[model samples]
Target: MNSTRRDFTELTMMSKEKWNDEELFYFQHALSQLLQYVNPEGLSILHEINREMHSRD
Candidate 1:
């Protein structure tokens, strides 16, 4: 597999562990940035769109 795909799988597995509060925060932050890059702005836009959709209901 490509390095990005491999790294993402590893991140998914690693994040499932019971990390300390600080470690979990850092891991989530890194994962979010990685996903943002992978989606080329889609992630942020989707989040904003989802917020608006939910607010409208």
Candidate 2:
């Protein structure tokens, strides 16, 4: 897997309490970007994040 996807996965696993609005925005941005590069397994993870992001709205 690419480092971009790896880092993004690690980021998602981390606690969100430290994430302010800007950080959270970047996390969402990273998820979108990673979706272009991920495999089937990674796609599932990103999709889950996408769902959570949408649900937050």
Overall lDDT per candidate, in order of appearance: 0.45, 0.58
**Mind giving the per-residue lDDT tens digits that candidate 1 earns over 1-57?**
223233334544543333333443444566467674657454654354344444545
Off by over 4 Å in 1: 1-17, 36-57
What TM-score, computed on C-alpha atoms, does each candidate reach? 0.33, 0.46
Question: What TM-score number comes out for model 1?
Answer: 0.33
Clash count, one per candidate:
0, 0
Q: Point to the candidate with the largest lDDT.
A: 2
